[model samples]
Target: MKYQDSLEQASEKAAQVKVFLQRAGLAAHPVNYAVCYDYISGHHAALCTAIEHKLSAKTPFDDFIMADLYSRYLTPANPQQEQLLQDASGIVSRLTGYTDLAAEQVADYLQQLDFSLLQLQQQQQNGENILSAVEQLRQQTQEFRSGQYQLQQQLEQANQQSHQLRHELEQLKLQRQLDPLTGLYNRSAMQHQLELWFTEQPGRRVAAIAIDLDHFSRFNQDYGSAIGDVILSKVARKISSYVQSSGLPVRAGGEEFLILLPDVDLRSASEIAEQVRRGVEKLRFVSARSKKALPKVTISLGVSLYQHSENWYQFLARTTDVLTLAKQRGRNQVASETMLALPA
Candidate 1:
């Protein structure tokens, strides 16, 4: 219930969020997505002010800065958890105080009893009373120790429950960063990974391949969205299969996808892209009811190496331009930045 937007309004905002992320070259990671969504909503004045300040200063958006902004502004403090911890601490403090007081009382009583024992040896009248007091003190000490043990167990359980709650929250946040239909990392996640890769290895060689399903919109229009979704999922899986463990595959909205290859050259990335194109082209979908083969699918790809001087968005834009050139020349082909530089 955190979001109150109707279906139409939410869809509109989601589209805008994509555009915003694309423009800023930010990942659609949960933190970045939340920040973008809230900013577009125009509801959080302080958040808006902070973002505007960064923009005015022309500060580039990085994962660390985005995470800081999210932690500072968007992340809601768990009041219940805070109160529980405080209450537990208070209990521990009080228990310590009581234990100290009990120890002092026991010490004083033991001292008095020892004196009384000497007196009892002389008087032999109140010996029974002193023994009875000692017995009571021993019983009280045992009961207090038992109570402390129980309280310690309860505190541990509460800590465990709090940890579980936090883990669940983290899992839920991660889910939001995935493309629901394609089951691939969304645009935000792609951005986040790009940032991390560059941060981990400064000036690392990276190749980006931008992919678009050829004539997908036309196919979607001819067939229903449900069928189109099936194709999209299959294509996503095909693209992901080629990436394996060496690269990141992302569903960059609509019928577009991206593959980011670190430690891979442009030529190697192009070969992989070509393989994906062939793989997707080879996949054959059959109509469930009619038992007829569906239309053949193909993809256009653009490959580029990350330039040291360029930001991720600029790199993506240039790659996309190459992809655009492929589409313009003809669909279902591979294009590279070198080709893009050539005279038309």
Candidate 2:
């Protein structure tokens, strides 16, 4: 009965060691075989020494026992132990193959993850570049808008200056076409007016009258030139007041004047010219220094009606010739080219 109890206690202790080895993740078959053989062969000191070394080396009990069995008992001469070592070697080789395959799979997975991270980083960089380009475009647009606004303001100022210049040009043109002393149309203005009228309405009844201040040089000698100027001004004012209401009066020369009458025949023009001569003969001028009545001013008039075939120059020449005849015949009288003889 005591032998049975000792056997049970030894069996229980061996079972506890097996459990401890298995829990430590060591091979069960190799460790159990090695421990049993060592005990049966009376090499208990070898087992104890191996366990102590394994404990010192921090090795699992089962792996320590397996290494001991191969080193001490599993040799080529012992065929049974060699066969057991071969089985253990087979199991370890299979386990190494599985471990190597698992390591390869893990390495491949890590490589794929690295490639994916690289692609994501590249996409992020592209997005940042696009944002930078958008900001640059916005700044350019703002600058362009500012430039356009300044251009618009400059254009408006230029337009205003152009308008003011045009108005000044018109005033200058008017001053050039007017006689400063008489306030009437000058000779150039008269010629231009006749030409414009003829072009606009051809074959119209138009008449030209030429008038001369009778004895102007004699009046300038007798009275001072200043008094003579007053007399001439008075005569010009009377003639302008009479003719400008019905026709156009122009200062033709120093002491000569011309009138242009549109839609008037030679008979009506002669009547108007005689009326102007009488009006001028009745003009009274006063000397500024003396404050006395000056001599009466008289003008001789000549008239010529425009012919459709004649230009402005030919008509004026004919009227001037008649004016010469009137001056030779008598002063303060009117004559026409049709009624007078040609100059000798």
- Best-performing candidate as measured by TM-score: 1
Highest lDDT scorer: 1
Could you give me the TM-score of model 2 versus the true structure?
0.58
Which residue window of length 10 is worst by lDDT in model 1? 120-129
lDDT of 2 by residue, 253-288 (tens): 557788899988889889889888878877677767
Instruction: Tell me how many clashing residue pairs each candidate has.
Output: 2, 0
Q: What is the Cα-based lDDT of residue 284 in candidate 1?
A: 94
Residue pair clashes in candidate 2: none
Put down candidate 1 lDDT per residue, 243-289, tens digits, no spaces. 96868998876788989999999889889989999999999999887
